[model samples]
Target: MGLTLQFIPYLEIEGLSSIGRIRKLLNAVKENKIVLLEGRLRKEEETELIKTTMEEINSEFKGIELAVIYPESQNMAFFRKAKQHFINMLLGDRQGLTIVGPASVVKEIKKDPNKIQLFTTDVKVKAKRPSKKKKNKG
Candidate 1:
């Protein structure tokens, strides 16, 4: 199966309740699409998402791989860090990226303070064997 990526802007989920956000993200992963959310989920929401995913796991759905990439405030200068905090306080969780994908396709998600690497399973395609024709002996 081909991989699909869905990019969701923060405005798309800005008004959704925590449960609603979780449902939307899970539904996309269930459909085999990797979700690229513009912002990270809250701590409680992240916990709830994992809990809900665990509950919904089945034979067909193996669950999900989630990763978040955000700027490290400690590495920033004090003034910049303070500014970031103020911005976050006013703008909500709009300072980072969130990635969610189905475990069936996504093998692993490696994240560092500044980077993310997504490894996937290669979907093997079967090749058809060519048939040989017999020559007539005259």
Candidate 2:
């Protein structure tokens, strides 16, 4: 006999709306599965997720937990670093695990090198396609 495991990846859908994605994400969580969310939820979506999770949270199902990754700069320019910081402050950074289940499903989600030493999933930001180029075409 052999143990079986499954991985379900939820990437951005071409025709699916934000609400649709949230609905699917919540549904998957309800099924007690680890979801590798492609992107971070919007501010409103995060709030809704927390609210919905809170309602169903119990002894068996803990709830949703977001594990973010913050990259450390190495010999970076002061102005560039400051600009990056300002941008992050305005539009929150979404660079890590958005686990929405019990600890049994996702025990430790880490991205920092220090945490990775203990063994964990190293999630990185998936590069976004340039949207500015589309405007230029118009």
RMSD after CA superposition, every candidate: 1.8, 19.2
For each candidate in the order shown, give its overall lDDT on alpha carbons. 0.91, 0.55
CA deviation > 4 Å runs, candidate 1:
130-138
lDDT tens digits, residue span 1-138, model 1: 678999999888888999999999999999999999998888999999999999999999999999999877777999998888798778778878999999999989999876789999788889887877788889
- For all predicted structures, in order, the TM-scores are 0.89, 0.46
Best of the candidates, TM-score: 1
Best by lDDT: 1
* Candidate 1 root-mean-square deviation in Å: 1.8
Question: How does candidate 1 fare on TM-score?
Answer: 0.89
The 10-residue segment with the lowest total lDDT in model 2: 1-10
